[model samples]
Target: MENLDIAKFGGTSVGNFDAMTSSYKVVVGNKNSRIVVISACSGVTNLLVELASGKCSDSKINEIIEKLRDIHEQIIIHLENQHELRNYIEGHLKEIKEQTLLANKGTNDQLTDSIVSHGELMSSYLFVALFKHYGTDAQWFDVRSVMRTDSKFSCAKPICEEIKVLAHDKLLPLINDKTIIITQGFIGSNTLGETTTLGRGGSDYTAALLGEALGVATISIWTDVAGVFTTDPRVVKTAKPIPELTYIEAAEMANFGAKVLHPSTMIPAVRQEIPIFVGSSKEPEKGGTWVRPVTKSEPNFRALALRKNQTLIVLSSPVMVGATGFLANVFSVFAKYNHSIDLVSTSEISIAVTIDAGTTTSGKAEISENMLNELRQFCHVKVETGLPLIAIIGNRMSENSGVITKAFDAINKFSVRMICYGASRHNLCFLLKDGDTTEALNELHKQLLED
Candidate 1:
């Protein structure tokens, strides 16, 4: 099949009726826009997550369900097909309430996926109705039908070969120049037909995966931000929107801590070398960022990324003086616990690494004592919390003789916990106390990103 354009809108972009209408304008404006991916209306997923936690009393669950109903009702009541949409949403809300009540108490990953996925499901339904009301030819599409995955439940990985075939069979025939297919993001089905989610902020991943599966010409992501910025705008109010970046730069930015796109979002787009456009739905006229295989601009220092809530793990052992497999053994323990290490630096006797200190989808501390016990069996372990990882992302950073000096000079006053350089040309990563993030970003942005 020929390549088509795909568009995915984030939560805030479709937060309510007005937001959806703004995104709808972006959709109809682009004739090539064949598939429109929607996330749950802003704040809905959190409520669903709370409901699915099974910590709530019957009344609390009822209350959450009612809030969800009200959130959608406000938007539905504005729809021309209010009566039909209300009944449709009410049925799904009822199912959610039933599932939440019956789930084995405590956080069940499988049940969580099943329940939380309704956010996207209901939003897509409402979006379809809204589009129809605006006189656009749109149909609701179940992404799970084509987005087949393994049964990992809360954080499922897609089976790419299966997805390609499924997309051709299920999605190709239905999408055309005039027809707009509205679909859910972040949720998919496993081979056993159980609902699975691609983790939080997976909507971008969903759009990229579909674009890769269907050979899309370009993938447009409409979010609250104008585009990828020099640094987080909140951290540095002067942070400017980046007009263009190479795929590598963008991927590094996402992986390091840019919230605009999911880290995994770059994988599919990279695989197919598909270009992605990110812009704000509210101010579409202001333009956005374009990520391509290669861009005309290539600056040594492109952007700074700050990933918060990082825990620094330091493993010390006398056996590591000249050990060949010590690194492998340490990583093996992380793999056993299904945890990923972000940045690492080593000395003859110790290895220091940074990892996310956030809770797992299962609602447990990611760095559990059990995993620490295993590490302790081999080496002394010291863990530090409240450290955030900062990444200086750029192009040919290693080749830029003065980049490091200039970067460090910018934030020289701050205490640096760990630094990981020479690993990738794209970034220089380090950790700092959480309190220093905003100031560090400000200094770094002024030095590296600004003229």
Candidate 2:
């Protein structure tokens, strides 16, 4: 209940006319000052990436382009007095088509960003049209002008000081003037005026950043789900919604594959203690999950998170025993490739680490041949694919005897891989076969979250 509230809709939430209609009601139907941030239509970003690959045949790219055109045209046909919005779409799509064709000739990160950023651009303006159709005064703006970022391209970091200035100077005035500002999320610009992205699932980060800059206490993320669940409801039918969580729990769950919020989404919001709500766009009346700092004590256990397609690498060497700078040398190789480890365990003779099997550019599985070859210079490295990680996320895990006992006992039927604890009191991580992931998650959810 702040003066100005920020609402961000994900791909699924704004994927179609029905979805956008729900969002339009949420934004325009409200009396408060609302800034709406939107993602691409559900499937647009993926197809756009294909078109940008430069490897796709002309016919294939043309097919994707036609699909994009059709999706927008379908929605526009339903609107009244949309000449301006339709004209904007026609001109913008033509430009984007040209950019997509030229994208393959550029650097990897830059090229990928150029194509993927179009998703948010298309959705934001389309939502503006939806709001207008409902007889609301709505205007859409370019976030690139306000969300100033560094030149990291796909994974660019926001220069907060610069963004603070731009957002406050340019956006605040328009917002206060009673203009419901709709802007694209997941994209920004570097100081050099190049289009950049905040990585996938960044719209959450976008809202958090803007909410923090506007000095608001909360940002609402409208998604397909009712709220953050104790477990993925699809996986465990008995799973129920969790109403509130500390900022730490939400971030930990996201990091461990609670897909409701992006893992880094908490960074901006946490800096100023801004509460974030994860709610349903389809049914706004149903309460959602709130992530913020709270005064009252919470349960010792919060939720169970499972991440599939994980790869574990174990490096063994006697040299690691009583060795100085040994771990540093091992990490240096990964740093050279810009690869990050997800979970790590080490002993006197060996070190084990887990990383996502998905490629950095797309969420598809990829084997990192180059990284493995480099590690051969030091120790005998063993790699295992098809591993899934299960993390029990909560607070003060070491003292929570009941939940810990129940978790292990519940998953006792399934085989467990590397178990890591104490790295953070907030999490207990273990690796298992990808096949056993679902069953293990269900049983653990039954005890830790459901009970």
Candidate 3:
């Protein structure tokens, strides 16, 4: 069987028609049967969101509409077979604009869905049209028709079994024909037939999910960056790209705070043991990061990722020093909020949990009020904000005695509040003051990479 390569282009790659045409050429250069997943043109999603929420003025909406029209027009002008494709895009854009305007006045879920969905709809149409203009055997596939989801608006969960059935029955036929299919990522339809978006940065997830369903050999996420870095270069000057990583390490780094790939995007790919690549759309020739199962390469520290604005909630119960399930009940409240626990440290008298301090500007005292009230029933809960959690991720760190020592020596000046290593020892998460995050990351990266 020929290896199937599924490539997903992010918003930056499809930000404009020139970029779209460039990416198309890159795909053609691969000279292989592949499916391309595309995100909406840049800024369109944000504009749509603002318009749908009635947060922007009519002038702003009109400006966005004009921009969208101009981008499509430019692409059409450059196409060899321009007339038909141009008309199709114009018609679609007009319809999208009208619907967007109509949906602007209301805050209904349907309106939000209609407005936010145009990004992918427009991009999918443009991608297919561009590919056809280049004389490739390309066809546009509407993701909503095949990617089944629940009725949740902002963060809909995929119905995998339903999706698998639909993929086999509806999508596989085109694959067999060797047709290059272009589909929008991040948008799907619920059972009730309402348009729903997968949460933020969901395009990568869409590509992985589709790759898994198709049982593809490889999934390539083509983004602006060359590959995943040892640490965010913006924070650590010496941070370098990691050539490869195990799926477990990549997932842990992503979950801890690596922005290259979404944490949940790896689930399907890992389940199938599919090789995933993170490469540059511009520099396709350059080898990028490869994520797969364990290889002969011994486990080494692959990357450091830091999630900021962390709040540490400490629950101390003098009365429950020897009690069982005391921590379970406290964790239940966090599960209810869907807040991810980044790090945890516990003792006989107290339990400390670290969570992301989402957008709330409230000081630690105010932020802990609800949790403290709940804890007041059995213990004293104290909250500390303005902190950050730095995660050191590696598959072999458990056997490397010097790893933790080196990390501490690197950032010795920073005030670390707590440390929690996962049961599997794949990750070491430490809490530091928010202001010290950058310094700690720089020091750690230098220590790991320089010598």
In the range 24-113, model 3's lDDT, one tens digit per residue, is 877887755478998888777776666666555668877877877777676667666677766776776677667666765656555676
lDDT of 1 at 128: 92
- Scanning candidate 2 in windows of ten residues, the lowest lDDT window is 358-367
Clashing pairs for predicted structure model 1, backbone only? none
Model 1 TM-score, 2 decimals: 0.95
Best by lDDT: 1
For each candidate in turn, give its C-alpha RMSD to the true structure in angstroms: 1.8, 2.3, 4.1
User: Which candidate has the top score in TM-score?
Assistant: 1
Score residue 287 of candidate 2 by CA lDDT: 78
Better of 2 and 3 by TM-score: 2
Error of 1 at 338 (Å): 1.9
- The sequence of per-residue lDDT tens digits that candidate 2 reaches over residues 387-436 is 88888888887775676776678778887878888778888887986685
* 44-109 per-residue lDDT for model 1 (tens digits): 989988887778888888888889998999898888868888898898899998888867355578
lDDT of 1 at 266: 88
lDDT, model 2, position 255: 87
Residue 1, candidate 1: alpha-carbon lDDT: 29
Question: In candidate 3, which residue pairs get closer than 3 Å at backbone N, Cα or C atoms, i.e. clash?
Answer: none
